[model samples]
Structures are given as C-alpha cells and as structure tokens.
Target: MKSVIFSFLLILALPLSMNGNDFKGIKRITANESQNESNSWINFVKLFELSEIPEKSLTQIACDSKYWLWINEKLVVFEGQLKRGPTPNDTYYDEVDIASYLKLGKNKIAILVWYFGKDGFSHKSSGQAGLVFKNDVLHINSDNTWLSRLNKAFEYTSRDYPNYRLSESNVRFDARKESFDWILLEDNLRGFGRAKVLGDAESSPWNKLVKRPIPLWKNSGLKEYKNKINFPFVSKGDTLILTLPYNAQITPYFKIRSDAGKVIDIRTDNYRIGNTLSVRAEYVTSSGLQEYESLGWMNGHQVRYYFPEGVEIMDVKYRETGYDTEFTGSFTCNDAFFNRLWDKALRTLYVTMRDTYMDCPDRERAQWWGDLVNESGEAFYALSPSAASLTQKGMLELINWQRSDGTIYSPVPGMYTSELPGQMLASIGYYGFWNYYMNTGDKETVEKVYNGVKKYLSVWETDEKGILVHREGDWYWGDWGTNIDKQGIFNAFYYLALKGFKNMSELLGYNGEVKKTQEKMDAFKKAFNAQLWKNGEYRSETYTGETDDRTQALAVVAGLADEAKFPEILQKLKTQKFASPYLEKYVLEALFIMGYEEYGLQRMKERYSEMINDPARTTLYELWNIGSGSVNHAWSGGGLTILSQYVCGVYPVEAAWKTIRIRPQMGSLTYAATENTTVNGKFSVEINKSNGKYRIHTLLPQESNAIVMIPVSYKKINLNNHLIWNGKEKRNQWSEYLGIDNGYHTFKIKSGNWNFVAE
Candidate 1:
C-alpha cells in the first residue's frame, strides 16, 4: 500500500475586471449626420504619429454591434458581439492596450463600422450608427472630425436564416466607389468635419451596459491560420473558389483594380460573413486600385468571386476563422482520421467561442445555453483558460434576464427576450450552469442565481402525467432534431436540472428546499417513464408516438431512465434516425455515460467522414453538409468533450477540481492521450492497452484527490508485480467499474506512473 500523493504546483491566478456600472461622462459620437443613413458601411480613419512609443497605451472603444478597430495597419480587434449594457439603457465600451501594435512614429488608426439598423442577434442598433474611441497617449474618439465615406461595395444581405435571422450580406465592390488609403496616414482629411456626437453614455439611449464581475470578451491576439491562400486574377468563366481546410470566422480582405463599375458578385456558402455590406462575388471595378477590407465577419468553409467577364481581383489575403486565447489542451491517437476529427472539433470550439458560446459563428453569434452545454461549455475547460470565466458571466446573464415570473428567454437582452419556449430558459441552461459550477467552485454564482432557479422551476406547473407543459404555440427547442418531443425532452432536462439543484442545495445549505425538490423529482421520474417510455424508447409526446435520439440521450443523463432499461436504450440510439450536429453532441455524451465507448467512437467516425475526408473543410460543420448554412458550429465539437470525459476521463468531483474522477475507457483505439488545465491545476494522462494488459501514466497537480476508475478484475491484476486490494471491482453498466479508493494506492510512489500487468 502507498500513501497519498500530492505533486502539482499551485498555479498563479490573474485578476480580471468585470462589466462596467459607471460611465457617466463619456460622450457618444457618430459619423457626420449629413452622411447618416447615406451608406450601410462607413470608413473612418485618423492618422497620428508617435514621437516615441509609450511604455503603455490603452484605448477606450464603443460601437453599435460590429466594428473593426485597427491600431496602425495591423487588425487589433474585430469585436462583433456586444450587449448595450447590463441594463436596458447602458452602452458598452472596451479598453485595450495598443502599445504593442504601435510603432515609434507614423502609425495609422482605422475603423470600419457596420451599422445593421435592422437588428440581428449580434447587434440591435438604437437607430444611430456610430463609433467612439479615446486614448490619452494617442487621443482619439469616434466623431465627425474623422474622414469618412459610405462605401457601396458592402451591401446589407437577405438575412434569411432562421434562429439568428442571419444577415447574408452580398459583396459587390466597385473600386471606383472606394476611399483610397482609408487606413493609411496619407489619406486626405481636408473634407473631414465634426462628427454628429451623441450625448455621453449616461444620457444616450444605450445608457449603461453590463459591467460584469468578469468581462466576457477579451483580446486573445487572434493569429492568422498557418495556411494562407492567395489567388490570381480571374474572369467570369473562371470564378475564384477559395475554401478553408477547416472552419473559422475571419475578416477576408482583398486588393483589386478594375475598370469603373465592372460588376463582380461574391457568393458564399456560409451563413454569416465578417462583412455583409459588400457582395462576395459582385466586384464593381473602379478605375484605379482600391483595397477592400471587410469590417464584418464571415464564418464558413467555401467562398467564391465571380468577375463579370472583365473585372479582375489583384490579390486576396484570406484569413481563417478568428479565435482568442492560447490552446493549452492536446489530443492524439493511433488513428489518423480520429486525429483529424479531433483537430476539426477543436477548431469548431475556437471559431464559435467569442465573448460567449455562440451557437454557430457563421450565422447566429448569440451565446446559446444548450449549445454551450453541448460544445463550448466543456471545451472552455481545455483551451480558454483566460476566457473560461466568461462562461460563468454568461450563466449570470441568463439569470439576469430571467423574468419576474421566472420565465427565461433564449438570446439575452434582445428585441424580444420571450420569443419562444427554448430549452435554455427552461432546464438546459441550468445544466450548463452546473457544469460551470463543478469546474470553478464559485459559491457566489450559485447564491446569485439560486432564487431565479427556484422561481423558474415553479413557473410552469406539471400536467396530470407530471410532464412540464409549455404554453400553446410555445417553441420547445430541446434539440433541433427533437421535433415535437418537448414533453419527453423537457422532463429529462428538468430531472437533470433537479439533480444539479439538489447538489447545489446541499452545497449552499438549502436542505429543506432540496428535500421538496427531491420528492418532486422522485414522483416525476416514476411518472415520466410511465408516460413517455414506449416501444422500449421514450416517446417525445404523450400519444403522438414521436421519438428522437436526443430524448433518449437526455433521459440517460437526467436519471429519468430505469436502471434495468439502460441496455435497451443504448441499443436504440445506435440505429436511430439522424439529427443536427448540435443535437448529436448530447447523443454522443449519453453513449459515453453508458459505457458504449466503442460504438460512440465508431459512430463518430462514420458520421464525421465528410469533415475528416473533405480537403475543403478546415473545421467541423454544424450539419453533415454545408446545406445547414454553418460549417463551424460550437455544438458540433462534442468529440472534444467525449475525449475529456470518456477517453481521458478526468472530471471534477467537487466544485472546482478539488477532487476528480479519472475513469479512462479506451474504446477501439489501443492508445489514448490528452491533457487539460483546470482551476485546480494541470492534469495529463497517457494509456496503452497492449498484449491484453494495460499501462497508465498519469500526472496530477498538487494535493488533488482522485477516483481513478479502470477495467480489469482485482484478482487477476498486479501493480508492478505486487498484488493490490485497494480498488474494489463492481459491475454497473460498464464491463467492470474499478472503484477508485483514494485511501489506498497513492502517487507517493516515484514518477506517479502505474502498471497493471495481468497476473
């Protein structure tokens, strides 16, 4: 027997500022009013040379919804998602350090502000389109004093998509209508005048914006993709087809010189583009060279430019999807396709992860709860250490938007918060909040939202069958594929929520309330199975006989399924109908929990064949094909989560990572390796199952307690040729649940590695 092992070093923590509550004196400024509504796109530039680069410089910025603020020529920040303020009238601003992007002298400051008067998920303008900036070192503000013109190349799109009403902007650029050197110091400002300055934030329509305990959006210094594609001039017969090897949200800029008014239409398969003001294939050639820099964002896999028999594009510098923070996690295996799939899933997380967990960066840049639960919610634990707290901020915002009656909405602070009965406001959103709680043991968060959780639970009463019912015409968005199965799915999610609430109740010392919840849960579980379970699987509706894979997935995770029925439910999912990538995210997770690791891995390979085999795809798509309008959807990145929970099997046993569960189930692969960093510390694992025996090498940060569960009977196993009786073998859904007894085997042994050779 060994002693308790504690070897990890304490990680240094960095403090971050939250949303702003005070902005009394800063004036809101906009483009000169004479030009207001004159063009959809406004280009503003101010040239200033620094005598000597300052030791430090910070800039304050605010815009309608979308703005590209560049310090010098380098693209500094392409902030797309912003809330008005925490409240109804607050305007939001960002403070960024510009010292690194600036030189000693001769620097250019440029801004391309896109005013989508027609509200979209990412933006809802207060009618007046504007930009504001102020920096003591390099004094600046968004006012009429800056040179500006409405560039006609960027045109507002059809905005035809459903969930987000995606602004499918068309780009038809005529260089002749362009502003030359718009981002250069040499651009003439003689025509520039006073910008129609709005009153300071306090007096403006957007008076106060959310000042979070932790800001959601931070500059990760987005880096260009390793592979950059440049194409030569081409005409109508030969349209330039440019596709990314993966999915990302990027600002695609190009240089072109064409005869005045030569039409070129740009077409895109992705639902959202960085710049919607311009046509993707429509290029109106100006007499001279005009550089087109899209302030808007485009997220997709393939884009093309069609020249009208003559218009020519000089060259295009296309950047891949943008992401913040540094990637600290890694995953690899013996299978090459699996590795590629892992890479694509990781990219999906990166592209869809902005200020919050976007459902899909390509279309709706809104932070969705169920989507977060499936994808960005867990991936945050891996790559986004700096922004992971953003998830908590998002959770608070959901509760912040909770109505007095306890009903919640989908997109927070939108034109209509109570659009439909989405799963987010009901039960799924809290499921994600629990995940956040487990990863980062923040009691304040639980305390902050406890009342809201209670109120929300009591908002809707259960039917005679004990299923939570929604209002007539209420849209139940459990999973896109769970059509009309709201009853079954919602209850499953409610059960999951109750379990989390019960855990929180104990943690927060609300025993009396938890007991009532437990009683209700006990009753609901019995009623749900009786009402919904039919044909061996749960029906989505009471008498409609509808069934979806998501219903079963949620049932398994939510504890609504009977222990005896696990085998039948697991078999049904293997041969079920298809679902969107977002829905599949949960389905895969359910399989992992049931110890169907091999089937899940095999299903992932067969389902994600396109993403892995297609050379055009650089990231995972939201659907099997580009038809769904999103190539890189956050919800589709379930593989990364699966790898973490099932393959690497390192999960939090308590709030934060005080104690963890290490249950590695290497499916078909002979070897699996992964590393992740949590608030607790870094955890790394490597496993090799060769010659019918297993060898596991593990690393855990300081004083961490763990329940390391693996297969193999205790009687037949020997640790380094020594018989060990510390772990108890139990049979559950898995072949064997190796109960990890922290009291026994400790990492106090040298190297913290162990071997279990078959005796």
Candidate 2:
C-alpha cells in the first residue's frame, strides 16, 4: 500500500531545476474569475521533483490577505502575511526561507489563503484576491501552472460576524466538502482550475509592495488542555468546558466522531470581553471519525465547546501562538503581591503583541497610539531587542498615514481615522518617539519622522498669554473618566512634545528647529506656571471642575512643576482619584520620580489588587475596577515598567543603554533583583537592604557603564570588601565614587561584575 501511494505521487509531479533567480514579471494568481468576496478562502497546490535538496532556498510570497503554507505535508509558514497598506494603497509581502523543508524528490507545496475582503480598524481591504510566490534558488514561481480552487468548505458561521471594528469574521468549516488527501497531491484534481493570472508586482489595487517589517509568529505546535483530560463525550445539547494554564492567543483543535451535519461551536471565555464582538468558529462534522482545527485566533483562560444533540468527541487541544519575542528582561522582589503583579503584567504585554502592539487581543486589535506609547515603553524593559521592531513599525505607520494638513490619527490602516489630540501628542512626546529612540538608538527613524512631528505640532496656536488655545481634534478625549482637566492636560502634553522634538532637532543637527522648539517650550512653561499654578495644583483658570490627578501627574512627569510644590501636589494626588488605569500609570510614575518610592509601590499594589488577586485572571485588566473592560490590556501593565525601572532601580541614561543608572529604590522592601536586556547587552542587579546594611551586586554588560547610587545614610561603604567611603571622607580605594546627588552617594563602574556593601 505504501509503495503504490509513493508511485502515484511520482507520476503526478513535475521536475524543476533548483537554480532559477528571476523574481520580476511573476504574475499574481487567484482561483476566482470574478471579483472576490469577503472572507474567502482559496487553496493552491504545486508538485515538483528535486534531484537533491539545496543547502539554501529562499522564497518571496505575497497575498492579498493571509496564507498558510505546507511543504510536503509539513507546516512551513502559518498565517503568513501582514495587513495591507503600510501606506495608502500598498501591500506587504513575506520572504520565507524554505531550504530545510525541501526533500530530495517528489516534494509538494500546499498553500491555504484566508482573504479578509473588508476594512476594519487595523486592516485595509484590497478588494481583490491574489497570491504570488517566487523562489529564486529553487526556481519555483507561482503562475497559471499552479492548480487552484476556492475552498467551498470554508464559509462564514450562521451566526452574525464580528463587529466592523475587526477585520476577521466568524469561521465555519464543513468537513464533508473538503478532501483531506489533496495535501498529498493525489491523482486527478478534478475541480481545481488553472490560476487566473493578474499583472506583475506593480499592478493596481495592491500598487506598491514592501517587505514585512516584523518576524513571523512563534508557533507552540499543539498543547493539550492542562486543566482537564476527561473532556466529557459531549452529546447534542451538552457542552464541554476546558481551561488553559493562562490567557493566551490560541487556535482551537479537536478530533471527534459524529453523524453527518452535527454542528459544534467553539469559543473562549473572552469571546465578548469589553462587551465587544470578538471571534468564534463552528465546525460541521462528516460521518465517521474526523479532526479539525481553526486558523483564526481567540484569547481567554477557558475554552467552551457546545455540541448539538448527536456528536461524540475523542480528543481536544489548542495551539498557542504569539508575536516572535522572548522575555529577555525580568523583575522579582521580596513581596509576593508585587511578584505576582509583575508576572501578570508580563503575560498581558506578551498576549497583546502580534502584527501590532494592540491594546487588547479581543474587541478591536487597533494600534491606538496612546496604547502603543505605553506598550512600546514596556517592551524596552520586558521583551527582547527584536520586539523593538514592532514599535518602529507603529511609529512609521503613524507618520506615513499623515494627512496633507499635518494632522496625524492612529488606529490606522483601517476605516476609523479620527485624531485624538492627547493620544497624538503622546505619540510624539518625550516618552513616545523620543523614548523609543533613547532605548533603541535608531537615529534613522527619528530623522525620518522629525518633519512629520514638526508639521503636526505646528498646527497648534497659543493664546496671547502663551497658553495653548485648546484645539479639539476630531476627538477631545482627555481620559476615560470624568473630572478631567482637559486644558491643563493639553498644556502639559504640549510641553513634553516640545521637549522631545527639541531633543530630536539637536540630534539631527537642525539647530533652527532646536531654537524654535526651545522658545516654544519656554513660553509654555512660563504660561503654565504663571496661569495654571494656583494653590500649588496645576489647573486652568477657565476650568471649574474637581482637581485632576491625571493633569497633576503629567505636570510632574513632563517636568512642568517645580520640586518646591511637590508637597501640595502630592496632597492633591492623595485626595483625588479620577485617573483611569491608563492615566493612573503616570500618577504612579510621578510618585517614583518625586522620590516617594514607597508610596509609588503602595499605590501600584492598591490600584491593581483586583487584577492581581483574581484567581480566575492571569493578566491585567483594562480598567482598575475590571468592570466591562478588557481583562488583558497592555497599557494597564505600566507597573511592570515602574517595578523594573524604579523599584529595581535600573534605567538607561543614554541611548541604547550606553550609560545606565542603578539607583535601587528598595522602599520598605528588604530585597529586590532584576535582569534587563538592551541593544548593547544584558544588565543584572540584586540589592538587599536588611540588618541596617545595604549589599549591592551588579553585572554590567560589555561596552556599557553604570552609575550606582546608595543612600547617603549608609555611613560607610565598601567595594569588594575594600573600604571606599567612610561618610565624611573618601578612603584610599575610592576612585569609583562620584560626589553626592539628590541624597544618594554615587559611583561609576565599568563592564564587569561588582559587589558593594554599605553600613
């Protein structure tokens, strides 16, 4: 039986050379003759024989939506292709290396394409269906020679589709209509037709093509449900419940035997998180035993399966997948609550990452710039260096989608194009674009985006008093909750924006811009303090609402407030509680920046108690109260940044971590440790504050330097057990000591492991 199958595969295959290098003039092919419909699926297959597999084979593949490729029944690329419109009217392509997957002879390539033929908040529809494949080394190019057909088995579920905010629709697959043997390239593909050829790379609808900016997703193959093994034989009208180890972005898979036409429904616990439409799938079984898995992804802790009256299930599982990134940075401390919060934040950040840095995996996978600003900053201290590429991609998208009038809106490459002034300001401000550059040292990106940032900032006009005349964009969103001091928040953000732009201008040698932005910054600061500073709290004269903690937090964060007023400002933050989880981060950061490290740590724990302590949740929630909001929001994980950078007390002073500051703010905690990776290398530190003494250990990366600071209260300090400081005077081996700064004794050390003790 095996020999007969092998002989049949050889006869239906075509022999091709492994030495073609031409990529031009390859046409886009589709099985559909007329215009393609929304949520369409097409299957393409090619068979070729190779005398010997080459050492290196690379292929470039482009498609309208997304495609999954299989080389000789082995999955090579899963869900390959980025959303359309890097800029308007252009598409992105994937270049995959297939060298290892090719065999010596009788190799087959099968591709399944899922074309999202409609527009949404994160995707732009091309209104056409096509696939183009070119292998310069193996000489395999897709054209009319490839056998193709529309997969009729794949269709929309009978239920309503996901909300218009989502590009993906509810998927339904009928096993009876699909022949699983097609992947083996069986004899006589009767219904398959010659692919209809479209024009070359420069063709319309998909005008210009750019390479995919990020790496393909990391697939965790198939992982069984950890919470349950006895998946009850769900009969018609019965449901099966299973749970994952935690919340994750995953596709569902199961095998079962059922009578024909028995339908089963699959969804996750977060199918309707935030009370918004997510995604689900339906599978119609054929007679006898069969297996099926979905390609669309859904995220949650629990998986639910609803069976109509007459189906028998055998096995069930899921395949977890996410953006290609690793946790090269981590933080842990003496408190279990803080440690648990850090772990949850890390999970939230990872699950929300994919084609973009989404606010959440469900509801809408839109790249809201405000969320991206926080997400990008968190990535620097949590994920590997490759994760920075996503931030770069989002930064470019924001500027590339700029309107002629210098107005920039986010959640782009989709239908909704409204500019939220605060979000837009944050996108280009000190902690947004400038912070990304400071962490990654990508000078080219700063140069490319400077002009756009300048143009957008130029649109604002100030009143005679140098106060910004609040100009509302399409949306005037200050924050989520009420009692928002919009005028005060706008001025603070503008100052930060000017500061970031001025720094960029200096970096790019645009001295004229530097001078202009400095003047603007000076004017704004002068006006803000002169007009908004009343009772030691920053609020506009025209506002008559309650005190705004968010504005005060931004004032401290943007350096618009003086240290002399921190006493009163801190009092206001203590009494006011209007900031949402998103804005609450700024408030906590302000506390850390103001030398109130203990209070900062306490506030973070108190504000995140519900999310951190919930036995059912493994990730943070979109709101502090966790009411009707997304349970997994990356923006809410700002505590991760606070813990690593403040409590662990490790942050970069120079771009790409060339120079770092290790000032451990242990607060009331007795011990803390962290390992953070940068473009240069990994930096790890551990600090123990017990027995009325401080023991500090640090391992600095090569080509990097650290300025370590210990409290001035430590009367005597020793480095490597050698006396370095004796409170009043420096000892003989005190070369590493720098003078005191802001109540701490500082030292500069080079690239090696160093240990210090202070009493």
The top-ranked prediction according to lDDT is 2
Give residue 690's error in model 2 in angstroms. 0.5
For model 2 the TM-score comes to 0.95
lDDT of 1 by residue, 263-321 (tens): 55454566434432222334456676666644445656555656566655666655543
lDDT of 2 by residue, 513-594 (tens): 8998888888788888999999878888878999999989999999988899898888888889898878888999999888
lDDT of 1 at 310: 61
Highest-scoring model, TM-score: 2
Predicted structure 2: clash tally: 2
Question: Which stretches of model 2 miss by more than 4 angstroms?
Answer: 1-23, 231-236, 728-735
Q: Residue 144 of model 1: what lDDT?
A: 48
